[model samples]
Target chain A: MNRDGARSSIDVLERYSGETYGRALLGVYLAAPTVWLVSMYAGHAAAGFAAFLVIFAFGLAMDLALRRSSVVLYDERYERISRKASDAVFNVYGGGGFVVFVSLIALEFLGYYEMTPRVETLFLAWSAFVLSWGVCYTAFKSRA
Target chain B: MKNRLPELREREGISQAELAEAVDVTRQTINSIERERYDPSLELAFELATYFDATVEDIFLYEADEDGV
Candidate 1:
């Protein structure tokens, strides 16, 4: 038995996991739109802006619904599930950014692409790298 | 990883908030450990064990089966 045995009678409070989940919602919102915009303006206007907006709105609603309550931890397993999902996104985004950056550099060297003043590609690549590593530690390291 | 933090904490009759203050962590962090949702760094684990006047093994247990890795 441990000291907390006395307080054991106190029911565990379930805080909503969606507060963190809200971030994922925000990530998808940002990522999808940005990608769509890049593709459209870069040369795919066939992808209607209205269509992306509708899909983004639906995701926003889903995110809100998921984050409505704070009981993210129904049990240890639920925490694990959320952690894994979050980590997966972070890792993918991070690794993908690096690959894209290197490819972009190669393209530029070959005169296959031109640099745009409005888009600091290197900075975005760096941001994604740092963010992904941070999420990796926060999410996976917790399980350690 | 598994821990007996809640059990040790209860023996002192201190709330998670109080334990967190003593150990310099957030209450949520303490709760996360108690619920086995998160594992503290070795330094933090040692701090908790020391604060509780117990060995690390006395406070936290390692279960290979549950290893997230």
Candidate 2:
């Protein structure tokens, strides 16, 4: 066990099959935005689907390249950095989401704007959270 | 949490990547330890000590708290 009762680095490394799930996650991250953009702007299901497939392929290529070249690990340093990033994200998301929520509601009530489907809007909100967290985590991971 | 890892590793003419590989960690983890930005786990400390043929105390040091002093 580790300092915080987490698994030891050796244990973590040994269990990793060199097939980095992080790379797969990075692939998903890359594909999601392209999916979003194509769906929103292209307005054609076939075009959106094509773009999704292509971008996902590109993401997989990038992932394979990274897996082959880099020695990524889920060591203590990663945990520490991830914790800090999560804390920062929470603060940013709470404040920013509140501001946006209030502004949109105010705009809607005042007849300045129209709201879309609630479920889809909530889905977008969740996507924004994921995007913000990925960006912040990567930024802090590199800098720290 | 301060350590003499960099000096010891340098004296042995070892790269961080090499040490990381030996210790089953990422190179960045070793770099972080050297820079005093991260404290290693007891398991890692012991492993590093064993690798360098030294005690943990020889590598890591605990400073007196300034407030207590």
Candidate 3:
């Protein structure tokens, strides 16, 4: 392998350290405290602790299973492809955000619905952002 | 931007992945160049030329637009 490849591989090795569960340890700890604080602020102080435990365990399990499995060989071509994807993602978020904003305003005016600072709404928003970026990245990568 | 990247790779009897490893790039980059879907940057073009023991022009044939784009 070339010097860059070796360096990148070393980076991957360091990030995961081959102890899969160990990679998730910090995430698991952080998730509990963050979720507990959010839940407690939302008037579910006691429930937060229970939810925290579940989330902590879930994060560890899921991250151990899924994260750091593949080490991507990034190069100039990958960078070029991803730049196109990033441009597309920017457009998607810019245009899509405007549409969503207008739609929400219209819905509120029509008294059909109200956007709230709830977990589900937050998740949905996150899902839209994630899916748009994912789709753009995949499409550009495949096109190339 | 048209190139003989695939032909050169074939002449070398190596996989795109192998060349990519040799040059510290991803196989998809090579595939993209071979397919004419992406153009390589000057640095990469030089690297590829160096790897193939050829000048950049030997691998790539560039035809400018009518308006010289």
TM per candidate comes to: 0.41, 0.53, 0.48
Better of 1 and 3 by DockQ: 3
Residue A67 Cα positional deviation in candidate 3, in Å, after optimal superposition:
14
Chain B structural similarity (TM-score) per candidate: 0.90, 0.92, 0.93
C-alpha DockQ for predicted model 2: 0.26
Lowest-sum lDDT 10-residue window in model 3 chain A: A65-74
- Pitting candidate 2 against candidate 3, the one with the higher lDDT is 2
Best by TM-score: 2
Stretches off by above 4 angstroms in model 3 are: A1-72, A99-144
The CAPRI classification for model 3 reads as acceptable
**iRMSD value for model 1:** 8.3
RMSD of each: 12.9, 10.9, 11.4
Top-down TM-score ranking = 2, 3, 1
Supply candidate 2's per-residue lDDT for A120: 45
For residues A82-114, write the lDDT of model 2, one tens digit per residue: 989978887787666767777887888999977
> Which of the numbered candidates is closest to the native, going by highest lDDT?
2
**Tens digit of lDDT per residue, candidate 1, span B7-57?**
888889999867876776556678878888788878888888899999999
Output the worst ten-in-a-row residue range by lDDT, candidate 1 chain A. Answer: A9-18
